[model samples]
Target: MIEEFVREKILNTYAKRTTKSKELWEAARKVIPGGAGSGFRYYEPYPIFLKRGSGSRVWDVDGNEYLDYCMSFGALIAGHAHPKIVEAVKEQLEKGSMYGIPHEKTAEYVKELLRRFTAMDMFRLTNSGTEGTMHALRLARAHTGKDKIVKIEGCYHGAHDYLLVSVFPPLSKAGPRWAPTLYVHGEGIPLLTVKNTLVAPYNDVEAMETLFRKHEGEIAALIMEPVPMNMGLVLPKQGYLKDIRKLTEEYNILLIFDEVKTGIRIAPGGACEYYGVDPDIVVLGKAIAGGFSAGAFGGKEDIFSNIYPLGHAVHAGTYNANPVAVTAGLTCLKHVMTTHAQSQMNDLGEDLASGVKAAVEDTGFEAQVPHIGPSGTVYFTDVEVVDYRTASTYDKKKNWEFWFSLLNHGVLTPPGLLEGGEQWLVSAAHQKETIEKALVITESALREIK
Candidate 1:
């Protein structure tokens, strides 16, 4: 009855406030699948339509302003419409947007990326994280001369068919915890793709080793997010990464750290620097380009030489390293996301996490906030979520109610938080006061839901 009451109350409130968004969703659904461009952008009833954003805040079509903790799913780590990004885009626009030929800024961008990601000796850009991971996997397979690859359960590298297995499998069909059955995330994934992809649980080194031993000399790489953000910000167990690195080396399998969500948001050098374990390749996107559509993959010079114009593996894109994206990314990484900005965002993340933890204790709510640097999420379960299996214990009803309550209170989290696949990101533009305000709103929402 309480859950029903909460849902009804929130739904009614949401419908009244977002009437224009409803109309837009109706129109969009007539043309676009599911009334939104991306599946993650849609929610029950309808999704709110936004007009514009600036500096950690977004305004909806209805003229309602929200403190944007979602930060465009951590893609806007420097915050929306940053002055530096705008200036760079304008300056680059004068020259051109896309050029199929090599440009100076592309080299500079790669150089900058290498400077931060010291583990990477060479780099290449792509249009999105999907392309980066796709290319990275191809490189891995080519370099190792193997077809099969391993993916951690619940880790989402990209929408590519090769790594789309077991992202959010139903526990009933997921088999044992240690060795999970590879459940294709969608219907269109080829059977051959599923056969080539393997599944392993997170935070368990023994299980991974079992998989490695069973399929020795078969796997090309083990692709994973260093801090599994796709499963509501799960943290890696202490020394788990280092052990995985050692294991991969022993088995002669390439380790690909998918840092699309964690690259710029977690640390300057991302998980590689934070964990101090270099993988064979690293895929980066999201915040790396300061909200532009860009992704990159890089590693040792020897491994990267597998790409075309050198080796047989072909990686090419018309929009790859477009001047607009490169200029924006260069500006963001070089000027905006400075050490001071990184420190400020990290401090704000800690503050927000601590505040949420305190709020949970005070409200007697069953929840845990796992955080690192500028990313975290409030899982509505008493258990600390170290992996996808534990993360599944979160009460979906409570999460939906809480998320709706926050939206009603002018705090925007990732829409997919209701489905336990997203996390809140603190941007450099986020001030301590805004974090404090968000905490107050979160506490109120938790109390109401409870």
Candidate 2:
């Protein structure tokens, strides 16, 4: 019944991809657990298989066009097929892929990153954020000699068991808002993993303080997204970030900022620059390596000393900073810093925030259009989404109407309205006209809901 109102006429993108996707889905079902690569991208009517993407738009196999807000789930800050990145990758591919032997370019890459992030020092790269976070956790445990780790509810770090728990767990079964049940997000997480992680509400320094004291020596690190952008752009209150930093330091707890989404996309220095909160260990992925797969964990010499090739930390991946990925990452990084490109993107993001706010208000709907730099997310409910519990209270029905309506109107966003709100990403490639076009689509979608 709910699906009826959520879906309007057949999405042209879906219609065009139907034949190809049906063939692919049938073949994929026999091997892949899900027909899609990621669970979040799968839609009820099936997902559109992309053929190619331009600056800010993507075309499916059926040749249907969409103004992609997904942006490869916050990866392509340069947009797909960015010329500089393309050239870099092509040049690197001509040289070779991987040697497992470190190259001079690796040091150059590290130096550029060091110049920008400032928080990163002495680091290693991985194939994905999951591997990077997994290794980072291991290092934290090794450094502190502690088994327990503190994480914020509603914030997703990666697919690893340690961080996967308490991600969008059912509130009926969840414990208090201050104290949440350590429920694993999926099937295979061990009982011990849930027991080890202490879930704290995001932005609530009091809850974090209580947990730190309660756990005492057991807690190794307290990691969180600096801006808490997962719950559709929930910003930190004034003094909240500074307080978190102070408390973590006071408790002898290592502060880790999971900047996987906000890394290079938000600014040259990532969210650390955007908010001015420095963390002990900062993890990055997605846009950090252009559109390629890569993740990195870097920190001060003290903490990084616990890792391998330096100390005892064992972190290795087959494709860690392969030449192609390194080239892509370097290209993206340079693009973000060159010509003050982030300033351009941030300005566009401000315009996007204003447009979304005006569109929502024009429809007389209570919503929050939270944004930071080039990243923005739309929330359907008016309730202040401070933590996981409050984040779950969003209006799903209306969100789906807005989501599907936007999709039908030629914009592509992540599906699963029940999971969370639509994450909006505008690239440097997204021009003023593109943003205005998105505003037109978004405004129409909101009017449909009213």
Full-model lDDT for every candidate:
0.90, 0.80
Q: Candidates' TM-scores?
A: 0.98, 0.95
Task: Name the regions of candidate 1 deviating beyond 4 angstroms.
Answer: 1-6, 416-420
Over the stretch 1-450, how does candidate 2's per-residue lDDT look in tens digits?
A: 445546444344345445776677778767876688887766666666788998999987666689988888888888879888888788888889888887877767777678778867776888898887888899888899998898888888888888998777889877898877777887987887667888988878888899899988888898888877666766788889889999989999999988888887677888787778889898888878888998888888988888876789788877887888888888788754464677888888889889989999898998867777877777777787666777777777777777777776788876643345447888878889989999998899888667
Candidate 2 Cα deviation (angstroms), residue 246: 0.5
Candidate topping lDDT: 1
Best by TM-score: 1
* Distance from true location, Cα of 140 in model 1, Å: 0.6
Candidate 1 deviates by what RMSD? 1.5
Clashing pairs in 2: 307-313, 308-313
